[model samples]
Target chain A: MTTDTTTQGTALADEIREGAGAVVLDQVAKSFRGPTGVKMVVRDLSLSIRPGEFFSLLGPSGCGKTTTLRMIAGLEKVDSGRIFLGGVDATDLPAHARNVNTVFQNYALFPHLSVFDNVAYGLHRQHVPKAELRHRVMEALALVHMDGFAMHRPQQLSGGQQQRIALARSIVTRPSVLLLDEPLAALDLKLRESMQEELKRLQRELQLTFVFVTHDQAEAFAMSDRVAVMEGGNLVQVGSPEELYLRPATRFVTTFVGRANFIPASLVEGFSASSPDEVASRQLSESPDGEESVGAEPSIFVRPERLRLEIGDSSGQIKGPRVRGTVADKTFSGGQTIVRVKINDDVELSVTCDSASNEARDASIGGAAAVTWQPSDATLLDR
Target chain B: MLGRGLRGFVALSYVWFALWFIAPSAIMLIYAFGHTAGLTQKGLVNLNHLGLGNFWQALKYPSGPVLVASLENAVVATALCGVIAYPVAYFIARKLGPRTRAIVLLLVVLPFWTDYLLRMLGWRIFLSPLGLLYNGMQAVGWHVNYLSILDTRGAVMIGLVYNYLPLFILPLAVVLERIDPLLLQAADDLGAKPWTIFRTITFPISMAGVVAGTVLVFVPMLGDYVTPTLMGGARGLMIGSLVASEFTEGQNWSLGAAMAILLVVILVGIVAACWLLATGVRYVLARARERALARVLVTT
Candidate 1:
């Protein structure tokens, strides 16, 4: 692709478009030699990020999310298999040779260089003309709204400003793919939230694929077009935010993506097929006759928000399966009240209710209530 | 109000400084400006007579050449020490693990356990005509001319480098160790190759160590007398040895004091030069900071 180097914005956009590619990992594995022995950090990890997509690798720390991102950035070598960038094998390429950039978790700004110089570093490496380098650097700084602080050293800037400069530095090169290893992990919550929006905007405007690694599921979900959930060096699930939240494939995903209540399958009767009222009424009739058949297999995973609490014996009218429980604990958390319900001696479920609702106000510790949820609201997963 | 014990301690230290340092310096200053008595007075006994005659005689052709040679030797030795110490420091700081780094640093400083006089004596034996080094070279089938090797300028350079190498390495290692490895990784991620990273990031940051190590090695080398006296036979007439000879063999105490004063002035000039260079760097950085602040203000 021929790019005009005269106009700065067009040049940058053209460079990104030409370099941007879908990153494909084919059966990649990485291991590190720890003090004890060899420990596997990532095992047979494989995923494809499409061009211009904001893909997130989400997991707890030590789950190999960062390692996987590093391998793609060529910061870490794959023990086996290959990585492809723009449909070319880049498995053996050094970090500098790869058309990839990373915004480090610590921001890692060169304390010796000014903000302008730091941002212009990548272009300088490319040996671009000085005037063009300045133009592109200024363009990047302006994009991050840091044009005024060009001459300031990285140490002089705040944490959030340093993060912005880091982003500008990485993106100024217009690499094929940008890897962000928990770039917002160091910022405060408010700044992180705003930077999340800014990152999303930049990804869209640049049209470059972004592979973001973060343990913060909310941040990942808020920013990603597709989220890959990892656990113990393996990819558990990859899907849209809503799909993963509503129809999680595993117990790990159910708990990791959001708060979930896992109930034994034996306690939930006809959880997959019947409504709460039907199951509750059938259970009530069976209880009078002293005959209750709790099914086996398929544990139920229900989000706290999906489970509702109603005072007194209101099981007959509830639309989903209902279970009788006493409110073990009730916490008023400003906007929502979290009520912990004990259904049996060993079974406890959390139900979230809006604080403004009468049900939340009525939920007092030691008071009797029925927890109900539609069969469709709960995901049935084999342990 | 100071405590009684603290006051006493302070007073004692001041008295010690006056007795040891100030008294000697004041006497030397007075002697440096005094005239050397002739055969009748015998050995600069005319202390009551003071003038600029001794300084003028010391700054003449012969003494001036000796001073210049001494300075040249010091400068070359210090430069060589800096060049040789940096890689050793980098290896210890960046490449080795903590235990190994500690061991290596210990080995580098092991020479300090021996007395300075003993170490120079050891070098003198090693570089002698029938020394172990000559026999070892002969065993290796290399015909090294032993006669030309010992008590030469080369020997003096070697002795100076050997003595001050640890001093140069320690500070450089400390500075290099404190650099965050993350910065290099960040530079790599920014498309900087290894050489470029070293040029742009590593070298510039380690400059403080370079300056500090230079001063550490150079300052002592300027006034070093024993190394040249032992290793530099005929060509080793440095200012320090010259002063020593004047005080002892020549018995020209006034001339020795004058030469000592000149050496002190030159050393002070060097220190002032280093200070100016450091302040110049700080001034540039401060100006850059001010410019940045100005730009920030204009934009706001």
Candidate 2:
């Protein structure tokens, strides 16, 4: 490697292929010496990401999602864990030595360099040929649709343009795994939505593994192939967006993923399985009386969109478990109005209805109604 | 669009500057153009005949050489300060912990609060024949000669560097500290080695501080007279000492005024020359980069 500089530089420029850019973290933990003392930020987090997958670490701030991402990027060291990139142990490797790159928050594009130079930075570091560097750099800029602003400085571009340049710079190296630390957080709402779609498109087209870190759960749901929700330095749950949304495992996961109405209840005896099949079968076989007969207390979680409201003079049969309550409050949000139904002693369940519907418009506060939801929609969760 | 109170403040500051700076400059200009009185006690300057003779005289053989030497000394001293202060500033800005950084900065500034003349005197004692440094060096088995070292250009250079180092470090440190560390982290993420990151990002951004610290040390060093007077016996004499002697011992205030104006001219000329040279170099490099990029673009 030391004999031929040009060959070595080109040799290091291996692009991540489709099935080789897997990232694995084994019992990774991190701690910081805070003002108080040594405080743990990430505790025993272990997960394996598939190749060409869009993975997200979703959590609130200070929950160590960013720390975990940094550890994988080799920007932050894991206290005691092994990180494997492309089947190579990279725990002790520095950020530059690892086959990875990061798109930072606020798009830390070099203010001194033009957009073209910035996108060419990783290529330059690999000492790629000048013609190829230019071709690939322009190719990346074209990918982000920022080819027109290649001559402009990073400071001269707007926030969205800078973001595009940042994206181009990160992907120019074709690293094994691209780490994104809240890269879309600094943009405005409309821009954020468009960029989210753009990012999803880019990830699919590139077939590169993307490790996205964000606190916004909705953004994770919109972009990830799999999301690992974290809380208090612990991996609370990991599943697909639909699986996690429908079958939340804990009280935190229930409330954090979506707006959920939780009812205090208990599981029936002899339902020991935790798989989806067991949950669905139990939902079909059990009656509402079984919830009252159980000794142990648990919470039944249901999303607001799953509940249907029946007003006075309804001739239709209630086929599922229903809660009899009076309408406590009605909030008229555009497209959807949330009507809070107060049932049996202070348990208020919010049922979302279309704002343009006759029932939503005619529903009055304190009116008697029955809020019915399918038993399959509710998940018995642990606190 | 200015508020009334701010307008008043602006007016008052201008008046203060005119009274303190412009008035003295006008008096100096008058003396530069006039001549010294020989016998007629019509003040120190004879206003009957005013010419460019004094300016020419000041720009000629004796004072001309002294001014050139002074410029050389100031240039070397300023360069040395920049080299020595850059690493110190970088260490304090980037490497030290937050708690230690404040302490180090305080130590850097602590010398500024002490008496300047006393510090020069301390350097004088250290460089003397029987001083602690001379004996300490002798004890280390090097038969060094302090008889030649004392009252030399080397001693004066030391005094200048020691006296003006804080000025170089303070502004440079402030600028280096203000550089976003996130940029360096980004570079590291983008496959930059530590030295490469420093070369591409840290050093270029720190050029602002380099220029500021250079000016802070260089301009004042040109106007300094005390260090050369105390440490420079005769061979190390600077233009400042010549100007000082002309005004005091020689009592030729007209000649002194002319020398002062000429010194100002030389300072401005050197700065403008450097600015032009830097601009030319920057333009050439930028053109080369653009041409290289254009070549690549054509090939692509």
DockQ leader: 2
The lDDT of model 2 is: 0.84
Per-residue lDDT of candidate 2, residues A178-254 (tens digit):
89999999999999999999998777667789999999999999999999999989999999999889877778888
lDDT tens digits, residue span B130-165, model 1: 898888889999887664667788998998899999
DockQ of each: 0.49, 0.70
Clashes of each: 2, 0
TM-score of chain B as predicted in candidate 1: 0.86
- TM-scores for all candidates? 0.87, 0.92
Docking class of 1: medium
* Fnat per candidate: 0.67, 0.77
Cα deviation of B260, candidate 1, in Å: 3.7
Q: In lDDT terms, which candidate is top?
A: 1
